[model samples]
Target: MSQVVLITGASSGIGKSIAEFLVTKGFTVYGTSRNPKQQEVNGVHFLALDVTKPETIATAMEQVLEKEARVDVLINNAGKGITGPLEEIPEEELRSIFETNYFGPLRVIKAVLPTMRKQGSGLIINVTSIAGYMGLPYRSAYSATKGALGLTTEALRMELKEFNIKLTNVAPGDFATNIAAGRYHAPLKQDSPYAANYGKSLALMDEHVDHGEDPQKMGEAVFAIINEKEPAVHYKVGAYMQKISVFLKGVLPSKVYERLLLNHYKL
Candidate 1:
């Protein structure tokens, strides 16, 4: 029997690519979106899901389980980007970003755990960004959200070990995706305090993303992770420089690493 895979935010970009690729690999794939009514892909099934809402999530999980009976793989790929000076970000907007980026995936995991435990095995893949490891200059909130998820995922991995369920964090450096399209920008003008620096940092971020790795490549990386009997807790998928930056952040002195990051962003 083929494994049943459930991927969130699969209507477009990396999520869509992963769902479509897995379908070709013989997994029964169920892809979710806030509005999946027209998210029809040749080999992927669409399910309506709004990760921000508890009711929508519960309803969507029910719909999937009701149809598939068992879901073996769950990929939490739904996220939005928020970029700007942390000082300028509204409190509510920061909270909202956390709602979708950090807590959203956890809610879905909670809904699926009972069934996964009963089944004796399951796999969870949380898609996080490399910026989470080394904070980005103008994207502090976005970085914070991903960092929170990464830490939470680590704890969950340890807790779920004896239960036969496995979880891993897939940290992508920069992937050509629609993530930048939905980015939240801080309100600022030429005379505003943070405008100049924020604009420069934001522009560099945009350039980095525009030249980032391919979204389709993530499908192969994730596919390999799923097939591993014992996968690492953290996996980095991006350009060699980006991956090296993450490594150097751990090895270099705090001030040295800070200087390096600032220089990279031309700050």
Candidate 2:
């Protein structure tokens, strides 16, 4: 029987690519997006989903379960990026980022766990970022969210092992995704300050994302992991920065690592 895989944030980027690849591999894929427009991708089904909304998740899962009795894989790929200096970011904006990037996956996982546990075998893939390991200048809010995800993935892996459910956290370096191009709302505050520096930081972030790795490549990496017999708890996918970030986190002192990131970002 073809395995059933459900991927969130499937309208574009890594999620879309993963869904496409899985379909080609003969898996029955249900891709989720906030937009209801039917995508004409071969061998995949698109379902309207908003990860931040529990009703959307419950409804989408019901649709998938109605079609396919079992869900073999759940890819928690729905996330957003909030780029700006930590001090400049408003509390509300920061909370929104956490709501989507962190809690969003949590919601989906809760919704899918019953089916997965009942089936006795399943894989949960969380698409995190290298920023999760180390903080970057001008991306404090984004980094915080991913960092929380990284830790959450680790804990989930340990907690879910006895249930025969696998949790894999994928930390990809900068990828060519619409996430960077997506609009970010600034944190609202009573007094406005650090506006000029925030603008400069956003410009720098844009330049970095424009030259990042391809999302399709990241998708390929994800496919490989899902097919493995003994999948790792964490998978780092990227060329330069992904490897370097892990190395620095392992060997360098905290202050030195911070300096290196500051210099790399030219902040």
Candidate 3:
């Protein structure tokens, strides 16, 4: 029997790519979206799911369980981005971003735990970003959510060790996706001091995204991990510079690393 895999945020981009790629390899893939009706792919079963909505997440998972009997892998790929200077961003807006990016995944993970615990083995992969490690100018809220998810994943790995449920956190560098366009940009006041720098930083950020690796590569990385008997706890998906930066983050001095980070954006 094929391993049953369920992925959230399957409507498009990396999520859709992963769903398609895995199904082609003979895995039973259930790809979810907020509106599954219009997000159909060739080989994925469309399930309506809005990660932020508890009822919808429960319903989607139930629909999958009824057919598949077991979900061997669960990939939490659904996320949204928010960008702005920390000072200008409202607390409420930041909370909403966390709702979608961090808490959203946590809810789904919690929902799946009971089922996975019963089965005695499972794999969980939460998609995060490089920004999780470094605070990006004009993208502080986005960074916070991802950073929170990263640490959550780390904790889950330790907690689930004895259960035979493997947890992996993937920190992907910019990929060619509509995430940038979908991201919320703070409504800057006409005379705000951040106006000029915001524009420059936003442009630089977009440049990294526009020039990021193809989303299909991310699917390949997922495939490699799924086939593993015991995958590593963390993965970095991007070009050499991006992956190397994850390494340099650990060995470089705190001040030196901070310098490289600021220099990357010419801050």
By TM-score, who's the top model here? 1
Question: Candidate 3 on 1-267: residue-level lDDT in tens?
Answer: 999998999888889888898988998898998887753568788899898899998998898889877889999999888888889888898889999999999999998988999999999999998888777788888888889999989888999999999999888898988888888888766688988777778888789889989998899999999888888878889878978887888999989998987787777
> lDDT value for candidate 1?
0.89
Q: Please list the Cα RMSD from the true structure of every candidate, rounded to 1 decimal place.
A: 1.0, 2.3, 1.4
Q: Order the candidates by lDDT, highest first — what do you get? A: 1, 3, 2
Which wins on TM-score, candidate 1 or candidate 3?
1
Worst ten in a row by lDDT for model 1 = 34-43
Using lDDT as the measure, which candidate wins? 1
Model 3: how far residue 99 lies from native, Å: 0.6
lDDT of 2 by residue, 46-115 (tens): 8988988999999999989998888999999888888665776778888888999999999999999999
Estimate the TM-score of every prediction.
0.97, 0.93, 0.96
| Clash count, predicted structure 2 | 0
Q: Is candidate 2 or candidate 3 better by lDDT?
A: 3
Residue pairs in collision within model 2: none
Q: Give candidate 3 misplaced runs (Cα > 4 Å).
A: 38-40, 188-190
